[model samples]
Target: MQSISSQTSKPEWLSSNLLLQPFLWAMSWLDYILAPLQNLIGYKRMAYFFVLPNLLIFGIFILIPMLLNFYYGFTGGDSILLENRPVVGAANFEKIFSCQDFFKPNTCAEDLFWRGAWNTLTFVVFQVAFIILMSLITALALNRDVRGRGFFRAIFFYPVLLSPVVVALIWKWILQYQNGLLNAFLVSLGLTKVPWLLDANWAQFWVIAVSVWAQMGFFTLILLAGLQGIPKEMYEAASMDGANKWRSFWNVTLPLLMPTMTVVLVLALIRAVQVFDQVFVLTNGGPGTATLYIVQYIYRTAFEFRNYGMAAAASLVLAVVLLILTIGQLLFQRRQEAA
Candidate 1:
């Protein structure tokens, strides 16, 4: 018994790790620091104190940058310094909007900007649709009782863990013109080598497809959580009432999942609008600017063209569009809750 117990017990160093002692001692000071503040604020209000650090970080990073961007939009100059920039009023915005025909980008003073805008619109519509549809399908499949279900879930989610740049690079190697795996496979099957990234339409298609493949996993996990939250008893009840599987899913599961679906939809929309990294690494807005998105346009305007004011104006426009979408989502969620 003594030998067995000795074998099962953790080693002394493992049981009380010396490496953690300093960290633990430092963390213990939090009690001294927070106790006085908690007493002054009262226990109920102490929640704010715990949350203060996050609010400070947000203010320092996100909120401040956004306010600065907004200010920079009204100023114009080649200089990056705000003081050197002259207040240009609405000239930057006017430049962006100075198109004769709204439908024709060639009529615009900033034709590239218009092109990027139209490309972004197309990307958002297609990417969001695919992401939502694929995510829901994968979530439903994973929620079922099947062999190796855990492995399948992990396989689907593994792509989400990869960096966007890394994902793009991997796909770039696979889609290369000369020695790409995809091209080789096509040749083996008696098909000619196709220019996946060099062409306009193919580049657009692949960027959207690759983005959908990378991000679908995260939304799938959200949907899976929603699916699991639904009570099994509802299915049982429906079964007793002679309802088919399709009927039970259509009536019960769909309604319960709508809230989660709305959250996923809005998140996907916002993410789709801000897409840049993967597409940048994959296409670099090449093939005659076919895949040049709004974010890329802003980036080039600020850095490449040295047009800080125009970049800031474009940034503000993008922010306004996102804000509208977010507001719409909130209102929809409010109505959903009310009903």
Candidate 2:
């Protein structure tokens, strides 16, 4: 057994392996080409060579699309092709913002767009709040010296591994009005059946709840890492000064965890603003567009209505909002660090 293990571990065995030979050959060829270039540019500048491939990919996939989307926002027509479209200036923006009462979406010319914006804002505010609170609590609980800690952690994080659509489908099955698992259980217990999806308010509530459940694991993991990175000596010092657990947590833990908490908040806010898949699968922005969000609005405008220009305009507006939020978060982080 020892001899067999030794033979398998040898470089000669690796070289002879069919599966790895192509990759090995490619690497050897790449190294051969890079050797001369490395000498010309020096080792320090060779970092650019390693980064060039990724930069090119990013430019092609991300940067080009963004520029096209921005340019498309200024044009109007039913056509998907950019070259044939006529530039309509800010007509799309004017249509969107040409509202008598900004608070009342019905007053807007593009009422559904405004409705989606309102719903997205509402969702982001509540979702971010609940996600932050729940994640913090869960992280604190998991970080403690508890029994079956690994099992509990795995259970909490398991949902995060599932795709968004899968998560939505699972929840939909559990929350269905007539034949859902929850409704069945309620019937068995002689309780009233709750209209989870049919009603507007209830639909919004369930969407937010399921979203929080599906995503809490990731934020909790981030918070747990932040908690672990904190210095134990600070807690010890607080204890020596006659501080209780709550006091120590407030003073030491919260302050130290602020940076990680900010990251979680920003990411959660962005995701909430861009929410689509779960809402689409679970509710389809239904019950009179009550749960409709901005991304869904953009999608419908482009594909369903075939108003590509309007979709592009709405997308640019969404991008600007996100960019502003990101810039604000960065400025706040810098101020915190300076302090």
Candidate 3:
């Protein structure tokens, strides 16, 4: 009876404790300040109040810059100040879009821009496909019951926590043409040193390979989570229907995993499109611009060449592409939900 009485009084004792008094006081003060506002807005409309701060931040940092970028894309000058810039409407777009043969980048007035566009397209195509395939495989392998699974999962995910520059630098050392780890291994095996970075083809290959190695872990984690969320009963049901393992995976797992796969695809595409840091640090758009992507082109134009207008124009193009992709993803998600 005494123990029961103590348990019942414990909550009251904790609430009246000196250590919690300051926090309670602070909360009371906050409530005092918000009381009038809450009364005016009502409980249902209070979500807007909570979101106001984040909305303001997004407007200032993202919305404002996007508007300014669009404005600057139409004007041309060496000056960074918008007031000092001359309105050369559509000229930047014309310069970028003009080409005798769209396939031949050198035919364009802004050949470097065209080159960067082609290179970015090529990179996105290869990188997104490879990353998705590799990530799915890794997730599947790790999802199974295996020895040292936790350790292997950590090992795979450790690289995603690293800085992009660090990942690039690490791979740069490993793949360097001369006096690098891979070259040393080749030399030991009585093979001539292969110029991985010096040759344009090999440079692009290494850049893509390194990028996949660095980022695949993140996607793997996402897919693994999705895989684990599937009900064990679904597989049992498939087996009861006399479906083989492969057939069950195709009929049950693939359909169930489509939403997660779509998310991975869209995110991977966006990341591939915005790829800059890894390529910048790894190859620096090297071997005669073979690996130069659109973001690098914009950076070079804005900072190196002092062509802010052109850079802004290129950025707008990139923004449009990304917006379209995002919209498409949303539509796809909606359709998936409807179905």
Best by lDDT: 1
TM-score each candidate.
Answer: 0.88, 0.89, 0.87
Error of 1 at 103 (Å): 2.4
Cα lDDT of candidate 2 equals 0.93
Residue pairs with colliding backbones in model 1 are: none
Q: Which stretches of candidate 1 lie over 4 Å from their true place?
A: 1-19, 28-57
Error of 1 at 2 (Å): 31
RMSD of 2: 5.0
Better of 1 and 2 by TM-score: 2
Computed on alpha carbons, the lDDT of every model, listed in order, comes to 0.94, 0.93, 0.93
Per-residue lDDT value at 299 in model 1: 96
In model 3, which regions exceed 4 Å deviation?
1-52
Better of 1 and 2 by lDDT: 1
- For 191-278, candidate 3 gives per-residue lDDT tens digits of 9999898799999998888889889999999999999989999999999999999999899988999999999999999999998998
Clashing pairs for model 2 are: none
Task: Give the candidate number with the greatest TM-score.
Answer: 2
lDDT of 3 at 162: 90
